[model samples]
Target: MAKRPGLGRGLDALLSSAGKKQEGEEAERDLKQVPIEQIRRGKYQPRIHIRPEALQELADSIRAQGLVQPVVLRPVDDGYELIAGERRWRAAQMAGLHEIPAVIRDIPDQAAAAMALIENIQREDLNAMEEAQAIHRLIEEFGLTHQQAAEAVGRSRTAVSNLLRLLDLEEAVKAMVDEGQLEMGHARALLALKGEQQVEAARQVVKKALSVRQTEALVKRLQAGADKPGKKPAAARNPDVLRLEEDLSERIGAPVRIDYDRRGKGRLVIEYNSLDELDGILERIR
Candidate 1:
């Protein structure tokens, strides 16, 4: 047969050379794979929150792919300690893998925790509460300042500050986010309230589908009540309370209030912008 112009000696020679080089590299390749049991869970894992649904999805992926990448770990007193890939390891166990691949390295506990936290944050794999907890752990456990932790996570100080503030929200509201019923915006809106008011506002937010601005307006209304004379302690009132006359005022759609005397005895003044609100209050009392 006649030699093909493109597929003759030159092409054959090039393919043979490339194949030999690949084989040589493969022969030199060294990857140490360890058993699943040999690698234990890390003592300082960064992930504070793991959604059960997410874990189930990870388990499914593990079943399909059989762990494509080895988990990173360090040698410990027991066997090996995981430095990262905790979720993968957990899912692998759920997937019933006999042995998982892991790469062992020597690193300090603090460094390992920081690495794990930074990895998760960069991946955006953590929820708001978990992110806040991670940042808090970096500050509390690792002795890092808020600014330092913010820098470590590649977030602005205000962003970190605001996220941490969410931690102060009612647990019910936090559960809402955990259950994926509410977003951070909703939580932020509720955070503007205090104590039971936060829970109440959260309920209203969900029930009324209130926008953030509307929620904020409700919060301001509640705050204005606190600012009114005789509504709050007499010690805290400003001159504006007097300028407004009556213990409280009601503009269109404004909140109604009833102020009592400091001695706990006085006329019960009811201020309402509309007849509907007046009737609504009366109906509730009756």
Candidate 2:
């Protein structure tokens, strides 16, 4: 079998070994021409939409150059269930293809979902909301963790966590993210706000078409004004902040203070017990 263009190394390795049977069966990923009507949508498919323009462009390509890659499938009772290449299947249908080439596999349900998620994620086809929901499915529906899912999809744990954070947005706010009216940064900044303030802030963000930096500023300004008098500020416990302090303290061989308000107004104070420690800290910073 040939490696498809634009397919990442991780997914390439996965698909290359996808259909070889475990112990019970000797089934291989033998390419077969399957009737389009017999193929059903993947049970674990998280991708909800393939843009019409993109599909049409794909269809045109399929018409002119033929489907360069065969869709992957697993056998069902009467037909095959799609494992990957749903976009190709949809585009082939658009190109008026009655039957398409496929490779039949006999993998289990969890593997099916993992492949689907990995493919979409690697291809960058899913929108932010869809991607986050898919990652959530990997953790919740498919019994993987943020760490495991991160490893599976070739992303950092922090990246997966950030993506998952988009799900915490209000339904309407999430919808805006889905439609690309708001980006992940915008959505993330909004997470700091809550209730009607959150909703109204989202509205203003959309109305003003604010940049992410501007959105963050808006959140900060709102938070500053919203604080009541005599309310004790919560200590900043951002992991990044703590991590930085730890790193600096280790370098300087002294205690480090990362002083910041809840509003992120602050300074870094490195406490050196000796002149040698102070010189070391300054050298490290340099």
Candidate 3:
């Protein structure tokens, strides 16, 4: 076993000893330096794709100051297997190092997977979809429920649930989120629609570079305008009056529009379908 650098305080804590140990046995595993080829990739990599540019940057750093923290690994038939720090392992190879530092732990499969996912989230290396899939796995494969998953990841139940809902978005929209074209806010707003409508809204969000607020307004207008299916509401010069039209339409069960000119004046127009509906509005108002 060879001495290795500490992983600052936070990541070191994430890897603290956790399994049953014999009486009087050492709880901490000794850090070791092992041949890079002998260390196999982990059972599952939460981050499937590593950006070459980022790996090269880390490699350059390793070449200069060396790997600040050793990768965590476990024993396998051939040699050792990665438990965490896939990025560091890949970068070391890019740095053309023959052997890298490691700490070998005997972690249970479920716990090992959880550790990998948690480390990736901490590094902000996982995209939204990858995060969701990892969380889903911790629930399904490990028989963990919502509360358990939340606790495992140190996130609020609501945050976890909201992130899971992102999976419900159309794959196209999700791809946008994963690729960083549309952020979580945009995905959340797009959730207001469904099927092709939601997908189209996501496209508009990216194409127009609309703010979250603007996207919400667009969704509302689209939904409210769906009564006539394809009819476009005429533009109202006064936005304040336009909002009034929406409010009146919702309140009165009819399409309403307000037209206004220069100085805060307008005509409120309400359309009614049947005589009975007209009578209903008259009775409600009077």
- For this target, which candidate reaches the highest TM-score against the unseen true structure? 2
What are the per-residue Cα lDDT tens digits for candidate 1 across 1-286? 1222332233234334534544555422334566788877777775666778888998999899788877877778878888778888888988988788776555555556666666676657777877777777666655544445567778965466657767788888888766656676677656657787778777877788887656755665666675345785324433454334322322221223345567756454444333433543454456
Clashing residue pairs found in predicted model 3: none
Q: Give me the displacement of residue 154 in model 3, in angstroms.
A: 2.0
Clashing pairs in model 1? none
Cα RMSD (angstroms) for every candidate in the order listed: 19.7, 10.8, 13.4
Question: Ten consecutive residues with minimal summed lDDT in candidate 3?
Answer: 1-10
Give a tens-digit lDDT track for model 2, residues 164-248. Answer: 7678788889888898889888887788777777778888899999998678668756776644466665433577876787676
Please tell me which model should have the higher lDDT, number 1 or number 3: 3
Model 3 bad stretches (over 4 Å): 1-18, 22-28, 226-229, 234-286
Q: Candidate 3's residue-wise lDDT over 1-286, tens digit each? A: 1222332233233335444431233544777788999998888667866778888999999989888899988777898888789999999998999999888777666557767777775567677777887787666665554545677688765456556768878989988988878877678667767899888888888999999768867776666674246787644345666577667755764556666667858687766533434654565466
Give the TM-score of each candidate. Answer: 0.61, 0.72, 0.69
Ranking by lDDT: 2, 3, 1
In angstroms, the error of model 1 at 231 is 10
Candidate order by TM-score, decreasing, is 2, 3, 1
Judging by TM-score, tell me the better candidate of 1 and 2: 2
Cα displacement (angstroms), candidate 2, residue 73, comes to 1.0
